[model samples]
Target: MRTVDKTYVIKGKPETQWLLVDATDQNLGRLATKIAAYLLGKHKPTYTPGVPMGDYVVVINASRVRVHESRPETKIYYRHSMYPGGLKAISLRDMLQKHPDRVIRQAVWGMLPKNKLGRRLIKRLKIYAGQEHPHQAQNPQPVA
Candidate 1:
C-alpha cells in the first residue's frame, strides 16, 4: 500500500507574474470572473486556499466594459452614511460614467474572499480607464 501525504507544503520561492487583460468589448461579469480567478490563484497548479500566491492583474480599457440588457439603468448600487438619513443610491450607468474603473474593480472585488488575505490580493489589481498605465516596467503578458 502507498502512503499519501496531506500536509500543506509552503513554497520557498514563489514566482510572481504580471498579467494584462484588455476589457474592450468584454462582458462585465465574464471579465470579472477571470480576474477574480487570477487574483485567487485558481489558475495555478499549486493553489492554496489560505495563501496569497496570486499573480498581479492589470486591466486596461475598463471604460469599455459592456453590460448586458437594461442593467445599466436597472442596477442600483446603494450606500449608507453613518448619519441618520444618509442612504444613497446610484444607478450602474452613473457609476460607469463617473468612475469607469470602479465599476469593474467592484465587480472583481465582490468575487474575492472577504478576509485580510483577500484585501491584500486586491492591492495587486490595477485598473486603468485607458490603454496607458504606469506598470509598463512589469512587462505584463497579454491574456488571449
Candidate 2:
C-alpha cells in the first residue's frame, strides 16, 4: 500500500471575525502592516490561499496615524492621467488634511495582493477619520 499526502482544503466558508483598531498615535507603516495581515487572514492557522478568509477590519481615528516628522514634507503622492500633462501631485501633509482615511487605505493596499482577491479584501476594511464608527452593531473586538 502506498501512502499519499492529501492537501488540506477548507470546505464551506472559513470562519471569520471582526476586528476593531484604534489608529490614535499608531505608526502608519506598522498599523497598515497589521491591518493587511488581518485582511489577508495570515493571523489564522487555517489560512488558505485564494480563499476570502479574512476578517472585517474597522479602523477609527485614522487621522491620528503618525509618521516621521520629515515624512510629511519628503513624502509626495503623485498620480497621472493617461492624457498628456495630466499629472497631479499631493504632499503627505496635504493628503492628511484632505483625506485621512486614504492615508491608511493606500498604505494597506500596497501590502495586499494586487489582483481580484486584493480588490475584494480591501472592501472589508472600513476606515473612519474620527473616533466613531458604525460597526458597533457587529460587536467587533478590539485588536489592540
* Per-residue lDDT value at 63 in model 2: 91
Which sections of candidate 2 miss by over 4 Å? 1-6
Q: Which ten residues in a row have the lowest lDDT in candidate 1?
A: 7-16
TM-score of every candidate relative to the true structure: 0.93, 0.93
Estimate the lDDT of model 2.
Answer: 0.94
**Predicted candidate 1 versus true structure: per-residue lDDT over 29-117, tens digit per residue:** 99999999999888988888888878999999999999987899898888899899999999999998898998998899899999999
User: For model 2, how does the per-residue alpha-carbon lDDT over 40-74 read when each residue is reduced to its tens digit?
Assistant: 99898888887888999999999999999999999
- Give the CA lDDT, 0 to 100, for residue 120 in model 1: 95
Clashes of 2: 0
Instruction: Output the number of the TM-score-best candidate.
Output: 2
Off by over 4 Å in 1: 1-8
